[model samples]
Target: MNVLKDVATGVGLVLATPVHMLGRLVSNVWWPLKGVKDEIVLITGGGSGIGKGMALKFADLGATVVIWDVNKKGADAVVAEIREKHGQDRAHAYAIDITDREKVYALAKQVKREVGAVTILVNNAGIVTGKPFLEADDSKMVKTMEVNTIAHFWTTKAFLPDMLEKNHGHIVTVASSAGKVGVASLADYCASKFGAVGFDESIRFELRKMGKTGVHTTCVCPFFIDTGMFEGAKTKVPWLLPILKPELVVDRTIRAIRMNQATVAIPRFLYFGQFLQGILPPSISDAIVDLFGANDSMDDFIGRTKKD
Candidate 1:
């Protein structure tokens, strides 16, 4: 009976593999998008840049949007803009340091009581210290990790229980291309983003193992975006790795969430780069990177003046 079961499993895999691949291909062009009208979405760093862009877009789509940022004025402005279009009940804002676990937990309970359970969480807040490893301050490095990586733990802890109970939620990690590959003068940023990418992947597996298939995860790895957060960054190959626009990144991220894409590397070319990176020898890969000047992309880096 065990032998028969193994044979059946092999046959099922053979039949399903090709169909699954085809479905994935078709999904890029056309997939039934999940609705957000009934969702309560919590966005970290929603005062500006990608977070603010997503907050506005989600509210326009009819989801109740919650903005969290340390900058009270910025967060309030975003909330007001959203409320103007969707009505006051459609948007809310909170000013709190995400790295403070106690504050995050307290706010989570308050949010649950005031606004419904957060059905989607965007861990989009991040910071960068654009300095060579030795020149960078220890405090800045620690802060970078706290904001870009550690905060995910607190935020997820705050909201994931409700998701697990309901068996429905989406967690979006706004990682970066720097997360996938190393760049000079951004060692701290790279390390934090790498942690974020790994966190998203691991949680995805855990959710599947726990039979919480309704809870989805999307890891977004986009090249340098022109949001003032990365003000003076540059790219060598304009056609291949042009600095992306915030609007384009936000739109793609929203689409990925609605379609439940597991991971999306912007411009699609990055996909090929990642594939090549894995198959090629390290020396050869490094040579390719040198040829493309990937490491030099941040040479002129003058990152956001005021940290989010």
Candidate 2:
């Protein structure tokens, strides 16, 4: 009887899948956010890498983009490039330390006044320190937490009230694949990203409970990209766990935001990683991780500074 019941449930889900997809398609067609002229989108850490890529894409799509970063020169350079490609008025750059709550709030208000209503918020700022657990200092750990995890709270709190009132907005949190699986030598980085993932989930739940389904939330977790941050990180299975390009990640991320996807794991194999951990024996899993040199590969880590 149990077997038959399970089969019936599976069949029901299969039959309902098309209807669910069709509903989403129709809803999106009626209320498309992509290429919506004059829509304001704000991206943190928009100075370089994935953030800069997304900003360029959005501006090309006719959105007014605000590039917020602590690196004023980098931010201005990106804005200059955007202005050359898309009209001068389409992109703006601001220097901001997202970790400061009051500063973030002030920036949000300034953006609203100077640009327009912010329809999209992308929290893409992060820093990674590759020290071993024993060598990790409190100051380094605190900075990581401030930038990667707590900044999300500050940004969300500052912008969400406006979203709730307007009833239209999207929030994208750029976390790391490290958040899903704990590896050696990156304890602090992993912990900070894990907190970001959790924070995204909790906010999603709160939105659902409040009946604000239109306020879309997406959490992105990707493996080592060819970004400056992971300059020396080696991939055990290049084909399976290939280091992604920043442009590719940015493209997919923008598409996800436009479509209002709730979460995304790049490389696709990451879902299998999650499944494996749930079923694999502890010793077996540990052996696999060790074989990949997943932890100690960062022993000679040289990040963005080295790239310079």
Candidate 3:
């Protein structure tokens, strides 16, 4: 009888797993956006471009939004827009450098006291230097790593403790599709984004080991956006790999977080490409990249001029 009972339990789980997954797939399609109301959402680099767009969307959903940016002016502008869309209390802004570990922790404490525990943490701050690896300045490379990759570590450390304490929180990383594959002129930027992708994967496993079922992680890897950061990037096949729009990225990101998606590649083409990387030979992969114009997307690069 004991042996029969154990067998029955194992069989039941095996049968239920597929049913549960199917149900979830249907639910995601039918009822996409969930949770998020009244949650405190903290977004780094929330002043402009994709960050600013996400802040507005969060406010529209009734979440208390916090914007953190090195450029205080840009953060303030976002807060102002949130206020107009929702109300004064719906949004807040802080001027702090996420690359500075000490400052990130300090601001986290302040935000906890003034706003509330951050229920959703978005590590979206990033920078790029569009130049060949040999011509790239050493300082620019270091800063790229600092802002694009290291900042995620510091921000997650500062806010993750509270989330773990409650066993309920979400961490979202805005990595790039460049993180998935190498680009000719974006070597430093690609390396930092690759780090971001690896970091998120490790953190997700850590949560699983700790048996923290309620904590969720979402990592987004998208192609270059039309945001000023990648002003001149273009695809050889526009329909296949067009530059992403900020609004589209923001919409997908918010939906992914609400639905607890683990990882998403914008347009879904990149997902197939990443799969091919594992099976295809190096020469074939290089040919595919060339055929798609990924090799020359940055030939006329002129990144954002203003420091913001």
Candidate 4:
């Protein structure tokens, strides 16, 4: 009986060898490595805050980066710094408004021609006007949607064909944690972000269905960030949901993009908030939200306009 048991174990090991080998082959083929050195990466709104942070990180990692921002001077400055640090050919800057579909398509073509095919696209351009729903003008609401939500579609449509052709690429959508929840004085902002989150998730699902698994999508949902974008905004839970630093956020986001993870939430606790919203009683959840001052915190919001 002991001899029979030993033989059975040996047979099991023999069968498992092929499975182990297959797993190793997949990892070797797909895992992040130095091969990304020559790949081109495009980051929208790359002149400041989270977008700039991501651009710098990618450039540091040896990928050729393009800074696409509406702020021509700011983008040029970032490009200068990158070129200074990484050599002149490592970085480039383009001043383009992503909301303009024609301009976005033109820029994508120009990037492909000049910088090589864009292997990574970061949709990070967004705007937030902290006006109550009733107080928001039609123009303000339209501009908010155009910049925050529609730009994603325009930019993605412009560059995704190249990714599909290559069958390898990453799309990173820098959405806010507010995308997952509704708050006061930010109805427009919340709607736009939520739309972005949905867009990223849907694209991911479609890619999986199409068997284009090599093309990865990551939706980053982080709480208030210390990017000076939300300068005077109050924090509901400073300890639990401390405003994330741009560097830290960019680091985690890069990790997620490298790993091809589906979604990334900063603080990790925000996942619990999502779960609680679904399970708790409406009144109890409402009371908790109110107690946390989630709605009222944006009342004093002083955005990047106040910054130099």
By TM-score, is 1 or 3 better?
1
Tell me, by lDDT, which candidate is best: 1
For all candidates in order, the CA lDDT equals 0.93, 0.87, 0.91, 0.86
Stretches of candidate 1 exceeding 4 Å from the true structure: 1-21, 306-308
List residue ranges in candidate 2 displaced over 4 A. Answer: 1-36
Backbone clashes for every candidate come to: 0, 0, 0, 0
Compute the lDDT for candidate 2. Answer: 0.87
Model 4 ranges with Cα > 4 A deviation: 1-35
lDDT of 2 by residue, 1-308 (tens): 99999999999999998897687568545645455467788899999889989888898888888999998888899899889999888999999999999999998999888888788889998898888888888899899999999999999988888889988888899998898999788899999999999999999999999999778899999999987888888787878788899988997788778778887888778877887888999899888778766766676777779334
By summed lDDT, the worst window of 10 consecutive residues in model 4 runs over: 27-36
- Pairs that collide, model 4: none
Range of the 10 consecutive residues with the lowest summed lDDT in candidate 3: 24-33
- By lDDT: ranked, best first: 1, 3, 2, 4
Candidate 3's residue-wise lDDT over 226-274, tens digit each?
Answer: 8898887778887878788889999888988888889988877787799
Whose lDDT is higher: candidate 2's or candidate 3's?
3
C-alpha TM-scores of all predictions: 0.94, 0.88, 0.91, 0.87
lDDT of 1 at 55: 97
Residue 189's lDDT within candidate 3 is: 97
Top model number, TM-score: 1
